[model samples]
Target: MLNSNMLRKLDMQDLMVFVAVYEQSSVTEVSEALCVSQSTVSYCLKKLRTSFENELFVNTRSGMLPTSKATAMYPHILSILKIINTCHSGIPAFDPTQKEITFNVCAPEYFELLILPKLVKRFIGSRFPVIINITKFHRDIPADELMEGRFDLVICFGPNFHRGVKGLRSQVLLEDELVCVVDKNFTLAEEAFSLETFVACQHVFPTPWTSDTNMIDGWLARQGYNRQIVARANSYVAALNMIAGTDFILTLPRRIQALTCDENTFSHRRPPAGLPNFTLDMMWSEKPSQDSANSWFREQIIKVCAEDGLL
Candidate 1:
């Protein structure tokens, strides 16, 4: 149902007109905002309606109410406008005080739970409102998609880097070691726990969000060992909660344990030998990585993480 002729009929200016009308809810307002005549705004709106074969807006007591179809199109239109603005010829001047920004990032739930709260708290009274959308980390996403600006940033373990990573920019954010967390009431509280004890005890494992791959499981498999997985949870919080008043123990990043678990309720110890420390990295496509806005946000993230001793 798609053809070049039909595509030619759809104009970027008309999409802009539709976005303005949707936001301002009046043709006169759109005209004044764009420094165009009322008639021109109406003409653009008419073209948009025809191209989409829908009455995009309807007049109601509340002003111009977008129809269901127009409402669905609203976000996509705004996204296109943002892409255009970002891809402008020169280095785009970023005025944080004047423009609000939504940053798209991806990370595992473990990292999200540990980092996002602190990161968001730092921006509470910032001049610009920064909205962060954190999606699950997908290690398999193609390099071309990232280069095409599909995601503004990604944070995950350094080992997660793939062939596509060669084309992206990355920086080490933090180095974290694995730690074993057990309820304070654990019977082994006074004893030195070894690798054999760790594998024998009931283990609580939190599954990865993006893939079926479980790092704990994979590591055990590589060592020709397996933990007694008494419980499996989709999130680190749930896994941590399940350890209380039980024989189960959790093995996870030390940072998460320090941030989420109460010291009095839980006892922490360094992981048994053979477990290696992991480095978390901040990755972004080269094209937008150097942009002023992206650079500013990256700095903000770095600052917060450092304050928490996560760096």
Candidate 2:
């Protein structure tokens, strides 16, 4: 049995390592799960042995087997640890006005233009330090980077694969509808956009990392018609700029159209009919975060969305 001194001397983190290795039957597996080095796991195991007065595990032909003494200690030890962990599940509040922590936000260009600016002003006025990394939204994800805490939060399209990292938190950001855009001075042959106009007009299709250009191609394939692509880009901003000067048309989200059209600047701007809508989501690795700070930031985002009629 592990006495009070044994428990006191053994850090809970080391015990967790020991428990994970015990259950997994391998140090390599536990090291990967905990995102730590194999040497660190081995070191923790040695400490556990010294505290427990026995080899907690013995390598057998089948697997690393936990000793009888170690088996006896599992139940009460795991229960107490679980209770301690449950108490920490709550996400904390963050008062940006006073904090000086650097937060990293990952997103596609759309969020950078439509979402980041407003959030940055709030951050600066509140004195919170931050950095934004703009990467193509369609790149193959690096799952280990997420486990290693590369990004504080991701502003992305719905669906992510890195949910096993223990502290993941996700929220649906908003449902954005698509719109048709053209230069204010440009004129279509018809006053109202029709299916025939959509099919015949020279089109500017933007490729944002996910092979969306290909998806769009597929969507239009069955129709026996497709847009003539005059230009393409992985960035939405580029597409927006190109559409501002030509007779060609581009599809954009309503929020973007809302920001881009200042009746004075784009008097003829309008979204065409028959495009689909999609949702954007906000996600974070929630586990290692300080609880109060998490709660505060998340609520602020939600509050801002509601105030702006963005939800």
Give RMSD to native, each candidate. Answer: 16.3, 13.3
Q: Per-residue lDDT for 236-300 in model 1, tens only? A: 88898999988788987877888778888888776677776778888888888778888888888
Off by over 4 Å in 2: 1-99, 130-136, 159-169, 189-192, 207-215, 222-224, 233-237, 262-274, 286-296
Tell me each candidate's TM-score.
0.65, 0.59
**What is the TM-score of candidate 1?**
0.65
Instruction: Report the C-alpha displacement of residue 31, candidate 2, in angstroms.
Output: 48
Candidate 2 global lDDT: 0.67
Model 2: residue 135 alpha-carbon error in angstroms: 3.9
lDDT of each: 0.79, 0.67
Residue 252 in candidate 1, Cα distance off native in Å: 1.7
